[model samples]
Target: MYKIYNTILDFSDYLKYDFLSLSDKPVTQTPTSISIQFHQKPESNFVWIDSRDYPGLFASGYSNDPTELWKCLNDAILSYFGVPRYEAKKRGLPYSLPLPNGQAIVQQDAQKYAGA
Candidate 1:
């Protein structure tokens, strides 16, 4: 599972990519990872993950301990890609490959939300 904490994704093409891709369906990939960067409000515990390539798409975390905010970003992306919240939480996001012909694997991993 990949954590989208302080890394900024340069691939604006997947600006719609969701941290929602953190999953446990089969645990197999090409061993690739994306770097993440984020922004935090100066006065509060508000944090956000925005992308230059993914304009209008962003993920934020605001909980006191601050681990579930990224989940919101995943929700936004799944919804953008037409996945409902209930279903996503239940079975996790679907697996897919990337790029112009690829899809972001944003899954709401239970462990991630559990703050593992």
Candidate 2:
């Protein structure tokens, strides 16, 4: 099955909360491969390919590995803050595509979270 981490509010805010609350005992297992696309975004950024399926969204600081996840989360935070020439550029925003290895996935620019 496919899982999606929809950012209900500001991506930064959600990420921040997740980091602070769940960082201690982060979900170590990899999440099922899914397409995560940010609201009001042009394209899907990241592709998470794991076997486990995460049912909810994760906060920024929350991670199984505080150190490693922190690095990635920090980079994501920086990119969201619009830091010029940041390593995690716009294309690095938290977005995913849900599809099997042999299947094709297409990105939609329309409003998918309008009424949700």
Candidate 3:
């Protein structure tokens, strides 16, 4: 299995390629051995792998170890494309793989009313 982070949507075209052409199913279908191809829908920022009909393997992100997931996916992409890790680092090819992170603001109380 191979994983590609697809930060700047560079590998978006590959997503349309047949990843399971050679084999009926992925050689290995574990969290660490599954392949990932991330691509955003038109006019969208989220990339999703719809494993609805897929059997054998899938890709998922970990909430606790987001950094590791990014690193691993980037590495896999570089390797699959036969690009040197150092060159990619120097060129900043990975672009920007955004993690599902954000903050929620809450209003504890409304403005205090004047003393009555």
Who wins the TM-score comparison? 1
User: How accurate locally, in lDDT, is each candidate?
Assistant: 0.45, 0.33, 0.37
In candidate 3, what are the lDDT values of residues 1-116, reduced to their tens digit? 13355433434433422342332332322232233345445664434432233342223344455444455554454454455432344333242344445431111111211112
Model 2 lDDT at residue 20:
53
**What's each prediction's TM-score?**
0.41, 0.21, 0.31
Q: What is the lDDT of residue 28 in candidate 2?
A: 30
Clashes of 3: 0
Deviating ranges (above 4 Å) for candidate 2: 1-64, 86-116
lDDT of residue 115 for candidate 2: 24
Ranking by TM-score: 1, 3, 2
Better lDDT candidate (1, 2): 1
lDDT of 1 at 43: 88
